[model samples]
Target: MQSTEQLDEIWQDRAIESIINFVRSADGDFNCIEKLANAVSDPDSLQKIVEFLSSTSQGKQAFQKRPLLGNIDLQKLHRLPTNSLGYSFANHLLTNNLQPLQRKSVENDYEFFAAHITETHDLWHIVTGCDTNILGEIQLEAFYVAQLYASRFWLALITKNLLKTVIYDIELSTTYMDAIAKGWVMAKQAKPLFGIEWNLLWETPLEDVRNSLNIILPSS
Candidate 1:
């Protein structure tokens, strides 16, 4: 029979391999973010997310209502005024060939968070001017960390990408660092965006929505 130590080492090796593979192929892949979150999920982080989602009236309602937006018709959004948030979001998805993420249920805080974030990830990119690229993705994760400091998933997600860039893609280190810095500062300056009723704001002008949300973009 294999020794317990040997079994432990084997498990560790598998875990490390999985992480490496994930980091290597994570670029522009939403699944990687979801996978990383799942891998590092803990009860502490879930509680922190719940608290973060409950601190504001909108967030409180979000937590209670668990609003799902993935089922909305893209054509309706597409027909909105070009300056509308819905139009921008729909265009972003259609141009990129991305589909809204479906959420079946929210049995827990983490599930609610994951589903909501997934559905709104592209919307965030549109609002924040983050491109659908590796740097933008990392920057977004850093923004999440700034807002949800207690979330191990966000922290781990940021750490892995930073390490990957530092060790394997040193040429990207400076730009990635800049992205992280920008995201952190932007989050600090902006009002909380979690648990927002985006459906209500879909018809609002994109800039109007951002202004109401007190979003401050990083300077060029």
Candidate 2:
């Protein structure tokens, strides 16, 4: 049997290989968004996005935007209004949701991006007004799978939804595709309007931030 240390080394090697493959496969020519848009069903807006990314500098800009979590203030985040969407989402995870993978040890920039995206997932949920219930999560995942070029997001959604169907009595298979379609519509609308600066958002009080950013909250 492999020792724990040896197993960890092997796992780390595999993880590195997977990330390298993902980066090479998706963005090898640095045209991942276009590739993703083409592979999925062609929606006009998505096609427009592809054209925009392909023609303009935004795709490169997005890819170039270095991860911004290095200086986040966890304490300030905790002090935000309890009812604020970000705070509420964080609370839900702390109190009821399962623990996500630890992020501190991630060394590669690409791996860091993947982990960053996973951590901010609830922010997207809040932005989309999707709850964290089984149905809602699957729906949100489908939308994310549709929008993001990361293959892991799509795979995670598929595997998790399939497992939910088998083990949790959730019936998501038939509706997931439709939910993704709807989410794409909403995301297109929302993405253009989402303009919060990372540092300002982290420090600003939720209500003030929401008002300033024009984020609409669902009625409680």
Per-model TM-score versus the true fold: 0.85, 0.50
- lDDT digits (tens) for residues 1-220 of candidate 1: 9998897677556546546666787464667756665556656567877787588888888888888774678888999999999999989889989788678777966678888877777777777777778778777877877766576766666777877877788898889899899988887777777777688889999999888767788877
> lDDT for model 2, on a 0 to 1 scale?
0.49
Off by over 4 Å in 2: 1-62, 71-76, 83-86, 97-102, 105-109, 150-152, 159-178, 192-199, 203-220
TM-score of 1: 0.85
The residue-level lDDT of candidate 2 at 19 comes to: 37
Q: How much is the lDDT of residue 73 in candidate 2?
A: 36
Q: Which candidate should be chosen as best, given TM-score against the real structure?
A: 1
Taken over the whole model, the C-alpha lDDT of each candidate is 0.77, 0.49
Candidate 1: segments with Cα more than 4 A from true spot: 1-18, 26-34
Predictions: Cα RMSD each: 3.8, 11.8
